[model samples]
Target: MPKANSALSRRAFLTSSAAGLAAFSSIIAFRANAQAAAGELLMVPAAPNPHGAIERLFLLHGDPLAGPIRKIVTESGNPVPAPTMESGARRVLRLMHFNDMHNHITDMHDKRGDTHRMSQIVRRMQETRAAAAENEVVLLLGGGDDHTGSVFDELLGWEPEEFVADAGYRVNSAAGVDVAVLGNHEFDRGAEMLRLGIEKDARFPLLSANVHSSAHIARDRDYTSAAVAEVKGMRIGFIGLTTQVDTRIGQPDDPDMGVASPVEAVRNVLPALSQVCDVVVILSHCGYGTGQSRSGKAGADRMIGEGDFDIAAAAGPLTDKPVVLIGGHSHTRLNAEGLNPDNVIDGVLMTQAEANGKYLGEITMSLAADQGRTGWFTHVGLHPIKSRDDRVAADDPKFDTFEKEDDYDAAFEEAHVAPLRLALQSKLAEAIGTVTAGDAVSTATVEAERYVGENALLNFMNDALVKRSAGFANGTVDLALFNATAILSGVAQGPLSFGDWYDVMPYADQVHIATMTGAQIHDMLQSNAKRIVRPEEADALDFSGFISRGFLHFSDGLRYRLVLGDAVADARAEDITLHGQPLDSMSERQFRVAFNSYVRLGGFSEAWNGKAIGAGVPGQIQGMDLRGLEYEESGLVYRNEIIAQIRQDGGISADAATLDGRLTVA
Candidate 1:
């Protein structure tokens, strides 16, 4: 991996006079002079005096490329515009924001091959900033989820002492990320691991206003709730806010550390940030929607209707400081119009680049001062990080496929990222065991099939959990259950590599067992009926919403027939049996159930909403509370358990292990 010293050296060289005149333009660089004081603003001094009197003006045209060119108005010393505020006034602040990278270091899925390579993306931004005008300041920001997606992230996370942090942060730091907001996934491995592993080595500020820690870990952790940067004489305050979902999805690093509500967090932090800065930007990982209606050409109004807490709705009323919100988590692509059909919001602008480093969102904000008040407006565009297709028309005889070559920096990749990429490929390409499926499968196939009913991949995962629980839960675990969406992708019917399996189950969730009564089990299954679509209600079904919530997938030993009724609330799960015997319905009858932490803790709101198994239910099951259950940690992550099962069974046979009639939907 590239070192931080090399990054600093590169930046110093770019700003040096020997690099050329263009290098001197807009030298707003992040300099690590010394360890920044907690909450201290990293201020870059403004450029030296210009040749003559310059008037700075901000133009809010719809075009991103259209900005106020240099305009010099010379009069015989009629008090030239004050150098402090008006000298570089014409320059616009250009921000490159990306979120939910999920450790996608390579452009593997880009068939067109024009997407941004992680290394190339950073180099391109640096080059752009190097050539920018003195007044033009470029800031790169990450919205979060910098850990736990790819095999490299997993491997590097396992070896934090040598790697310093996850590969994503190491690469991003080398790529020159100014600041990042903490996402829910950053806490996937627990807060302490993140603090000691990733946060300890981060080159930039990782802020989260809502995430609080009272333990000793907080003493060494330099993370602050907010940060300010002085870009071209203007102080821009950044208030970071993470989703409150960490309480449901993952364990906090410290026993005392906890996340506060995003709404309240924002409201509390805005006043302090606004007092110190001309403009305030909210760096959030809370997401624009509630994991539903992620994609569509829907306008802001309709999109807002689909979401639980959108950018405009969350931070709009908090303050009037020309706020710009960069969001993540739902991976929704938002534009400048702000989610409203009319694409207009008062005193605010919202934007988010899609996940996986596929696109880089650039927002050029034109700032103007009117009667002692500063006004900020923006022109936003999400640009694809394309690959270089150098094939010429003469080279490709079949169909004239000549196209404009994309801007791909080869030297940057070789120097900063290629070594790490090669290492990851070498380590993760090793074959673990042969994994087969009854039919061809991919992320799309498994996702599409699992929506309506049971599928082979989900069944395979449930079986692994069942087998894993027996060893740890005192051999009392009766059945294993999981959400269909937990199986992210499917393996091909061949020798499965570790990378392939990691892709299928990338999260860090662990297996857990809880005891629930037969009545509670029935209520849990009935609650799943909310996601089912009856024949008559097909027209009203929101497919995206249902899929986002996902359905329950249980082991073969636990069988039940789901009988759909005219209304979803009336649906019945009949003939429920455990190991071929009718389940006892006595109030005292109990069955030990095995499941991942996500389900055991009621993280799947759609399945546990009205059920008596988890929290917020009227008649909660005794000893079935999310955290109160005498839960035993299986000590193995979900993927490792699956790998262990596959290895112990010699090789998984696809045809023999087909989905049984365990969960029949009619």
Candidate 2:
């Protein structure tokens, strides 16, 4: 592995391969065109939705001609020439990038093993560049959230000062990251630790133009707002910005550091960067969206209502210096379709490699005189890290079953990250308890049933929450709620390991108990129902609803019959009861509720609803104060408590003979 900040040249990491170049050539068969108009080609498999289209060009070993390559299918595919660089044009730069890695040091589930495969992809691209004999400046970049997702990240909470140094920064350094932006999760441990740990030890410049410390803790530590890199005679200026949503979501409030508006930050830094660098790039954690509002609009105005900064809309008008925005935070998968007029401004290309290292965002740029500007994008691709042949079949026994699987890249793991994985596995593999026969459930089953109504896994989880919260509140807690997306995967039958528990509940959300009127709770259910996609509306095997919105699952004691219909909000939640007693309306009485901090903070509620709560909203629940009831922090992390509760109950198993019937959708 390369040492941190070692001056490893791009050529050393990227070796030419004839097979890779041949693969690229096979995928693109161009026809002669008399008109000089630039042609672009988008070749993707036949998928029902546009978002499902494969927009990135991938190279696989053994079978260089593998993948769904076909003639331009009008409904499913289109081939237009890439913006033409003159016949003698040279490739100025090639950026291999990804963001929102979320501390997935080891490959599990969909992710390819380690960062080694990502490096392999980069090497292949470099090989293609070398085969063409192009003067390519290859650089690797990260958008942020390089920390805090898997068991590895959770274990690192024990070592605050070495957090980033031991985890993401180390892996990224090995992957040869040329530049990176600070993600909001960087401060998950707090500003002081981030400054002392990650910002200090990073081999490459960690840029964030908008981040500043009022107390000078960060400023004094030398966290720069902007950085400049010279690659192959081209000067590129990089500015970073973290999403302001950090103020409300994770970690305790840091009175010292403040994140400015991304647009203003870019504008503030542009003049200085433009004076010295020929090309400017924004490494932003502020995601690509119209804003907080669900409305789809174009340009900077769309950023107004959304709390998090919109990179394309905010940074496009700030400069014309051939800028590119690499973004993260929302974990969106963006490609050619993302570059359409509605998403990005003219002359600005934005990209994000969906989370968990599943994909890489590749962009090729050329030094072109466009209206007196010296830089413009020539090509962009969002390549999935896995090869077309590497797909796991839906019917495979391990498809949704949670069991010990082989490491993604054993060679890479043994050489680079083995020790850490060993430590995590040893600690997480402790036998918490055993699930009896027929009681064990898989994530697939949980997700399948979660959308339409109740599921064994979620029911078990919510029941655990209710039990734990009630213990903390001295039996005052009425019911508990959790989002379906919070459950990442399911557990297999037999002796359950703490590692398995980590897979089931990985996030670091804290438990909060709040008071809401029965009416408000009903309204919350109504709001949740509006987001659920019915069985008829989605593909039979699709699991999108599990993540998007499946009505919140409540404790076993709270039961309701939900009637499904055309108007979701109008769907009746009949016989709503808690502890076998009819619940009162909001106008009648207030009830104690236990939920993760995310819900207490009004995560899913719309702005107009009075039940909506967040950073700036009024009437937001604070420290559990409702009708003079005191709020208390349980101090127990949600995942840890779930594990403890399972142990206390001896073991958890799916009840084959009975469905709890907590929720019934007709």
Candidate 3:
């Protein structure tokens, strides 16, 4: 699709690719032309043997077996039925894949009293495993957002290059992760630390074929790059890829990593692994466009269809893969297109559980061994193992009791290798301040944006910014907008402690200043409303507006009244006001805006066309990273207060879950 690779010539497209050195091994290279103008580069064994000797296999960089594929047929007699398996024999291949858990293992207390999002994730993960653990085979793979100082392998002072294995979480899993690739956050701890973890800490294999330690892979490479594991005797290969954006955002000392073309990574590895394995599946950490990102389709369905590579979007990619594609990054749910047939991407299933371990994705794939290499992947967002809220009771012991009764986390309290966390608690993880609306509330849990009923958080952030710049020439902006997407949970209106702020914001984003004209500002506000109050799907997380919050999560101070109760094209606004005062339409003015560093630029699926003005005060105050705190107001508490008030007024109300085209104006 990108100008057919020279390797895939017309001659190569029409006839059989010689088995080369593989036929002797029972493997054959079927240079089959995909229905698309491009090709579906599939490799399989020419025949199935009791010993299973097949040459010419293909393997991706990160995934292990690239499958949870149902055995279309068991290893049968010699003649492998014409490269394709029959449909009647197909069964579902149930598999569970998730990423970026970042080793978070415990409950976080909030306005709801106790939020056990992490434990909930683990419970569901275990549940899925228990239900299907004995199936032909199941894979638990990660997309690599394993942050530092988390549950397993806590990196305090010693660099990550020195360790391996997440010993703590190991006991909990019946079988730990089968494989994993890298993520940008993985670089935060640096490559060495990651390498050490993979080598020592992990019980399973780690694959990353696309990423080479140096020019050309040679024998004896120390880096644990890729793997090919047998699932019920099925040779399944996996590969890994990571975001290149890491280059523009981080410091030089970060893990200096690189990835080969993901499409090419498949081409190069699949052939090699397919020779021995029955199925070649790619576990991509690359963003999805499927060729669709490039406006082409190569996999099985429309989103992923048939292609040179049968890949899955390991991280959130616009395009999907024909084979198993597990998504990560952007932390959005799997409601996109290919996952969740209830909405349907050709029923091309995939899943994206909300971030912070809120949910897990369980998929079942069906493949035919007699079918040679044909297959299908389905996505499912498994019900997260959860707590009994005021309305419900916990069903399992795991959720019934949070082991948070202890003062310190058990994961860290008894760590043997090093005591770096407690050492840096005061400096890196110290609590030096508090937040509140009127009186002391949470000294440990500070609210970011109050998506909850009354938002001391949103109000505090906006009011803080106005107060911080009270005497400035440009004066404080009308409001400090925040993306509700960033709010973790609510803090009971009161004193906010340092840990509370970290749990709320959790990034290193600094406050920013912008010089947007009144018109641009208005455009942003309008889009802002469309993002928050806009009608959307049921029971899903809110979209980050494909952009970050500017005025606080749906908490825009009205510069002008917004009126919308129709389709996209039928929206308008009027009745302008600033500081509770009337305003004219033709007025042109520059507003000094308080913003997050990440949002200043377009963020994951979120972009605002606002011109930046200048840099403002740069401080994390009390050991907080400037970037970590989103929707900050220089005042006391912070929150997305607008949503709360509007909800109370009985209008502009929408679920904080999946942002879609559903909200109506009152």
Candidate 4:
């Protein structure tokens, strides 16, 4: 643990006493001294009501008895009073946070993730800080995933003259981000690039407690597990956690680096942080659930064993101080409108904004030392920062006045956001080809109907992959397969721009050709069948409730019929065919399959029985042995290959993207 602004430091006291006393004795003495010193800095409540108060508050959130969290209007709203009973003067701390920005720096006029409106968000944070009362402290925190997605992420690949690489870091630095947690996408380009990006552009420290790295990210220099900041004589401690799923992304060059269970990591850090700081905040990128929500539904928001719920549950027993977890990775908008009951878990107040600068999360907390240890959330607000067209008028009269508030500053936009926008404009607008007019491949519908059957967009992408992979495979590519979630968006029936395709598939994943036996293929398809949620069995909302995972969409040559059943495991994929011939599951017949690097590298985890899934488990692909798989990387990005095919054929039409009788869910 780093030395905090306290009278006695745990590390220092332990080290000084180590030589004079036994190891166990030294630790006990150090704790005794630390506790004595911490008592003066932070008071433990006479009757700590962590469990009872939080449970009651969570169950009755927004109800008058729970002291409903009120939204603050920037224009005219008065400061909210402390919800807890205060015996003396109360101090306020306003915390603002956002996550999963994903390098969305461009102005997407019709989209929700655009960071063009970032200037307004920055202005809001600045105004809040400046207007803070003498007893109030305001802070800006980032929940991670600040990079990846959008054309801006490919600025290094584009090699533009302006040298706008790592735009997310640059933007965060310009926005005056005080602290941020490390996200999985930060490792998408490997540890070296991540190190370079952080070193070159990050002004604030990026922290992760679970991540242990030797090469790219190092302790202290690159990041720290925990941090402390002093504001208006109050000490705030922060612990950062990254999802262990990042191991699937692979930082092979940094072989020593690995991500551990976030729960255990927080437990280790809490002993040190709890003794020094008045309050502790967990900066988490481990997501919100353990492969399923409290309602028992599975989706991409799950982080298995490394979610905030698990961490909070573990940390509750170890610390008596006020703890709040600001979460990301799931991109979940917790407390979207106001304080939500579901967000409080194990006595921890959780807050998360929707991904991609869509919302700015503001939380006001009151801390009072006179009434033992009293720290409680007074207000929670999520400010929508969308463009004028995307703005929806708020029905509640309390927020109606600020609903259309455009808090943009001309100087901020011109100085920080405009130059990058101008740099990518010409390249992004360049027309690659046109989508022939007709029923376009709708990404929304494709995702909605993904688990039911094959999707047009996925089929189109896989077909293009098969055609392109054949050249590099040195043999006929039998078929192509990939997850439907790989397609970020859909193409419209109009002139297609480079930006349009970038939006459709932004991940820079390469295609790989692998030989799979008929039996292995059958198993993969059967596993895909298990994830199918039929419309009759589940509602559309349930089907599309969370991000779809492990739902396979294959090329035209493959065909299968899904026999729907009452439960997930009871469902089956049968009558499989390949190129007009029945595929014998037990046969030794091998088919060369083209798939993206993500699938081959175990990026996709099959949805099963709501169990927590671990990363780097190659068995997700059924029987494909990672140790001796006969496969060759094409060294070509799947998206770029699709782009090349589009350029070669001039454009794709409705006929080319239509769903045939390749897959049928009966």
Candidate maximizing lDDT? 4
lDDT score at residue 246, model 1, on the 0-100 scale: 38
Report the Cα lDDT for candidate 1.
0.58
Writing each residue's lDDT as its tens digit, candidate 4 over 117-166 gives 56777778778766766556677788998877888876544222424557
Worst 10 residues of 1 by lDDT: 57-66
lDDT of 2 by residue, 98-142 (tens): 888877755543233234444344444455445532345667788
Put down candidate 3 lDDT per residue, 255-374, tens digits, no spaces.
Answer: 233544554554444443444444444454544333212211111111111222223322113212234445554454555333444323322233444344555566656554455433
Best by TM-score: 4
lDDT of 3 at 52: 18
| Global fold similarity of model 3 (TM-score) | 0.49
TM per candidate comes to: 0.77, 0.69, 0.49, 0.77
- By TM-score: ranked, best first: 4, 1, 2, 3
Q: lDDT per prediction?
A: 0.58, 0.55, 0.38, 0.63
Instruction: Give the least accurate 10-residue stretch of model 3, judged by summed lDDT.
Output: 613-622
Model 3: how far residue 7 lies from native, Å = 42
Candidate 3 Cα errors over 4 Å, as ranges: 1-97, 108-140, 147-178, 183-234, 241-276, 284-323, 329-355, 358-413, 416-456, 466-481, 529-560, 565-592, 609-666
